[model samples]
Target: MTKTERQKMQAGEWYCCLDSELSALRHQARVAVHQHNTAPPDPAEILSPPLAALFAGHGENCLIEAPFHCAYGLNISLGSSVYLNAGCTILDTAPVTIGDGTMLGPNVQIYCAQHHKDRALRAQGLEIAYPVTLGSDVWIGGGAIILPGVTIGDGAIVGAGAVVTRSVAAGQTVAGNPARPRNGWSGQ
Candidate 1:
């Protein structure tokens, strides 16, 4: 598992201090714009164009607002018809995958890596990567934070300002500080 993922991580981090990575990322987005079909295409403000291109393989309809931050964007896979509102932050030290038609409200955060609590490991300045996946049709409200390795299944809705530390299954609606299942969505 580590072998397959390590290369990508290395490839992505390689550009953290290199200009070539930025240039390459931008070039890819331009090519994608010409090669694929994108709606309301800006091609101008694709934030972190290099990083976006590296991670955005075939993921379309992504609305990434300015001032976004990430260690690596290559690990993210966003499906079509999705919107990421303002001030969205993705720690994406690992991989963050958002499914089709998913909606991310303002100030939403999806994280994929966390440092060890123990000082010994934390002192090393190393991180452990965890993958985050949002299933199709999921809706995450504003100011919410999805922690590492958490999965939100299809059609699940997370309330505003919730802190998700566990996984939520399909059709569940959850809220509160730690985000417990509030019961199934009240809709037909």
Candidate 2:
């Protein structure tokens, strides 16, 4: 039997994003996000119920500022004490796991979905998704962009405006586009 588009996407295989089931999921997520974003400045009223219900997993003490965005909220998980500042966007076509105590600065973007390099295939809406994982205590600076399949190790710091295309070692400090280790400081 052929797998559904969502199944293919979850398996990290190429799939059609225009599938009806996926569209419905996106719509549901948008509704939940709208409510969360527009809710009054009360954590108990917003995060505890509405925002928490949208995610696959949400740990205690997690705080996400308003204006957060995600394609499918169900594919994202947050650990305890995680804080996401304003303008954070997660394109969670695949699972996105953020470990405990992780902090994301304003305008941070994490994308799990990628289109085919072939323009023809991309034009047809063929896309692949890979999971993104951030280890405990990691800090992502403002405007950082983490691409598909990237794993940021524990306690690592991603400098502002970095474009992380590959995995970062634990405790490493990475900066610049296509992010590289800063000042020869290894994770040590």
Candidate 3:
């Protein structure tokens, strides 16, 4: 089979190489970030290089640290002055885009793919993908779980530990399992 074609065989060789390539890249980036951050400097420049390697496209002044995970290399893009804290994991099976000046708190999980709910199909490891987007100046609080195809609008604030299942409007503050708008516009 070709690179994208996966047979029902026990071992998928194509998948292994792709995964390995991504893993190596991530590892290298992680190491570089760790090394670069050993000494602190002015806050104006970007703080992490590992984060840059993980994205498909990235602008200036981004600071991404902690642990991160993704599927394909070309499925992610990020804008300038973004800060992603520790333990941020991104499942980029599809596309994931983050706009400028967004702050992602610790332990934030953003997933752009979902597996089948059916146990048999899920066990078979067959699944589809969906893309996710976040607008400019949004703040995702600690431990938020953003699901597939969710578009967080500009200046939105996602509360800590909320499980977001849908799109959020501009300047909205949302919280809860299936996040809904909190009091009012508090996007700052």
Candidate 4:
């Protein structure tokens, strides 16, 4: 039996993004996102339920500022007290898990999907996805872009405007493009 595109995507295998079911899911997510983004700014009254309904799992204390964007909200989960600032975007072609007390700065982008390295394959809309995991107490600075398959450890800090292409060690502070660890005296 052949696996469906959604199955392949969820399993982190190569899949076609142009599949009908996936397209429909994206459309549904977009509609939900639009509602959340445009709704009046009343955290207790307007935002929480819709945002909670959009994600696969989220804590009660999770707070996300308006203008959030995601390809598939069902693949994203958030732990307790997770805070996402304005203009955060998550391309959740695969699972994206943000742990407790994690904070994402404004305009932060997390991507779990990538196109084929081969031009022809990419042209054919073949893509591969991998999960992104941010552990507890992680802080992602403004405009940081986290690439596919990156796992940021607990208490790690990603500097502003950095591009994280690799996993960060626990308590490490990484800065700059392609995010390298800072040479500091203490991990704290």
Q: Report how far residue 4 has shifted in candidate 1, in Å.
A: 12
lDDT of 2 at 150: 98
Measured against the true structure, the TM-scores of the candidates, in listed sequence, are 0.72, 0.95, 0.75, 0.95
**Model 4: how far is 61 from its true place, Å?**
0.7
For model 4, the local distance difference test gives 0.91
Candidate 3 lDDT, 26-103, residue by residue in tens: 465456545544645546647455446556799887876645455444567889888888778877666789999999
TM for candidate 2 is 0.95
Clashing pairs in 2: none
In candidate 4, stretches whose alpha carbon ends up further than 4 angstroms from where it belongs are 45-47, 185-188
Model 4 scores worst on lDDT over the 10 consecutive residues at 42-51
Q: Model 1, residue 140: what's the lDDT?
A: 92
Of 1 and 3, the candidate ranking higher by TM-score = 3
lDDT (Cα, tens digit) per residue for candidate 1, span 50-145: 445556453665666544555556667888777777777776666688888898888998887666677765665445667899999999988999
Worst 10 residues of 1 by lDDT: 10-19
- Tell me the alpha-carbon RMSD of every candidate: 6.7, 2.4, 5.2, 2.0
Candidate 4 is scored at a TM of 0.95
- Tell me how far the alpha carbon of residue 96 in candidate 2 is from the true structure, in angstroms, after superposition: 0.4
RMSD of 3: 5.2
The alpha-carbon deviation from the true structure for residue 156 of candidate 4, after best TM-score superposition, in angstroms, is 0.5
